[model samples]
Target chain A: MTAESNITWKANFPDSFLWAEWEDEEASVFFHRGSGETLLLNPLGAYLLKTICSEDISEEKLAQRTVRYFDLPVDEELLSAISVSLHTFEQKGLLLSSASQ
Target chain B: MKPLDLKPGEIARLLRSNGLRLQIGPFAVSLRSRLRRVAEQIAFFYGDYPRIEADAFVDFHIQINNPAGLRHWVRPQAIFSFDGFKPFKPLPEDQAFAMFEWGLNWCIATTSHQFLITHAAVVAKNGQAIIFPGEPGAGKSTLCAALVSRGWQLLSDEMALIDPGDLSITPVPRPIGLKNESIAIMKNYGDETLVGPPVTDTIKGTVAHMRPPADSIVHADRDTRPGYIIFPTYSAAADSQLDKVEKTRALVRIAEQSFNYHILGREGFRTVERLVSRCPAFDLRYSQLDSAIAEIDALL
Candidate 1:
């Protein structure tokens, strides 16, 4: 996965999330009462939540960075699989993609 | 530790499990964590035995039996213990460890104090505990998390330990758990120091625990007299207020809600009688945290 797509999904989460932590088998979740949304996440999704919590990044860069962190055998298929996870996060309202990306 | 032989004299015993050695004091307990985290909120809140002095001890002895059963014992000044036959199958993980903790608290609190433990959020100020008891989704925890942040000593977020002898509240201060929305909303109001990760999909939307302030934990051993009993109900976006409840009516309401009132029978009735006579009861419905805090603080 390219770094851009990886963390870019974090943009959807609001800054007011009170508690965001890995729930393990359930992955990580971010709770925001303002939005009244609690998003469940997977391992990569949780990583994305932490990355976004730390700072903002673009989609392509997020995808790339995520691939690097996993130490997977480098390839486009690996990148595409990771992007699918990002899409699931977006569907869950956990990530917001910038139109520019 | 030997598999706790649930015999008569074994109400309280110390042993080793999972590398942690726990000293089970009369009402309190002390444990050393075998894992990396200092002491999980559970240990600190429930293990308030006199051994809190911090002596080097073995890792927290852990026996999966009764999972959260360790929390049921009362603290140093009192002795209350029970041994339930382990269920052939562990309680399904869907129920929280907190529930078991509260259940165990119910058993011991009822046995020793002959008091009913209620599902509620309780707070104390000036030696009086104001109980906000209700069912889940009644906004008890949300209101409680807010009140403690505004200076109320958190007596408990889940268990209201009422003494049948005097109708007073025995403080069992512990971390408050907030499900999904409440977790975020509490932070929006400016409390950001919540501990523990959020658990998802078990029952509550998402859940997390906020540590009771240091002072609450330090004074976890102290008891607060019952002052006012308020049964709180929270709304999504509605006018908030507290109104006085009649004595006879409030008595019935409490008996219905108390965890141990039935355990002690007549004694429970008289104890609650003493409480209503000495304390005022109210029905509070609130949607705003600030207004709720202001209303309660002003009453204190």
Candidate 2:
């Protein structure tokens, strides 16, 4: 187990976020009412944000869920991509992280 | 009664005296101007618009006049005022009519928070409307002028006023503004009589306005459902093409083009969301007006 895998992540203001998704399109539009900011997210980014909004999850579990949800191979590439998205969401003030117990 | 029903002299008298109150789409504007050019242009371009009574409620009280100083006689300048407050600096006297048109657009776009306003050109056929949202020099007005000439109703050549409640676009059909090469292009493409003489050396380069069709003004009260949202780019080297835009990207693009999206906040987001979800969006690139019109016509 890696140290990064134990970090838990969740939406910063889950109640203030609004999402609009079209089934035919791979992208989604999200609005954060707390900051009044609108952002465009790809399918993977959207799924991670949505999952975090529902409940707090550790990085390892998130990666496992993402792999199962997208039918993606569990490898270093997928883990790296998910890591980048999580950090990006943290930077955008859309998500926050903490050390897990 | 329409402005055309009154003689030119009467129009000028109303403008200089108690002000000429005219019904322009959803708003009533009272215009007071001492300039002969301003009076003449209003009579010429806004002839189809209905004239309101002196005692009626007015949405915008506008005035365009020569500044009171030596500047008035020397270089000569036109000043635009909204409800007696000057919102912009004085411009050259020759640009008074253009200033009036631009000033009215500012009044609507800035104050009318009742609707979500996007910086777009809208034209409709058979009760369905297509919104062309683009920046300056993107040929939106040019395309709008062309479409109107081909019998489409001009909802607006500048702003798309979307009713937040219903998501229907309200028609505020006014004169279609043309700039530079486009002025000549529209002249050759449509009725030459409908196009006004070009005023050179203005802020927007050489500018002219095409008179809105009388039928469009007559049915100004009718708002149409949005059918398509198209972002147009005019590229002389590229072939005319219409490509699908994802709704998510479409919403972001339209929000960027909007004048008061931030002001409306959540309601604005929901309104734009509904609009994008309801309409199919596309990015249209074209140089030839005929082919562009045909592509847009096929969508309707």
| Best candidate according to DockQ | 2
Per-residue lDDT over A18-78 for candidate 1, one digit per residue giving the tens place of the 0 to 100 score: 4333222244434443344444445676676667667777767666567778766757786
lDDT of each: 0.59, 0.92
- What DockQ does each prediction reach against the true complex? 0.01, 0.74
Interface RMSD of each: 20.2, 0.8
TM-scores of chain A across candidates = 0.60, 0.90
Q: What is the DockQ of candidate 2?
A: 0.74
lDDT of 2 by residue, B1-300 (tens): 555477789989989999999999899999999999998999899878998887899999999999889998898999999988999999999999999999999999999999999999999999999999999999999999999999999999999999999999999999999999999999999998999879999989999999999999999989899999999999997788999999999999998899988889889899999999999999999999999999998896
Estimate candidate 2's alpha-carbon lDDT, on a 0 to 1 scale.
Answer: 0.92
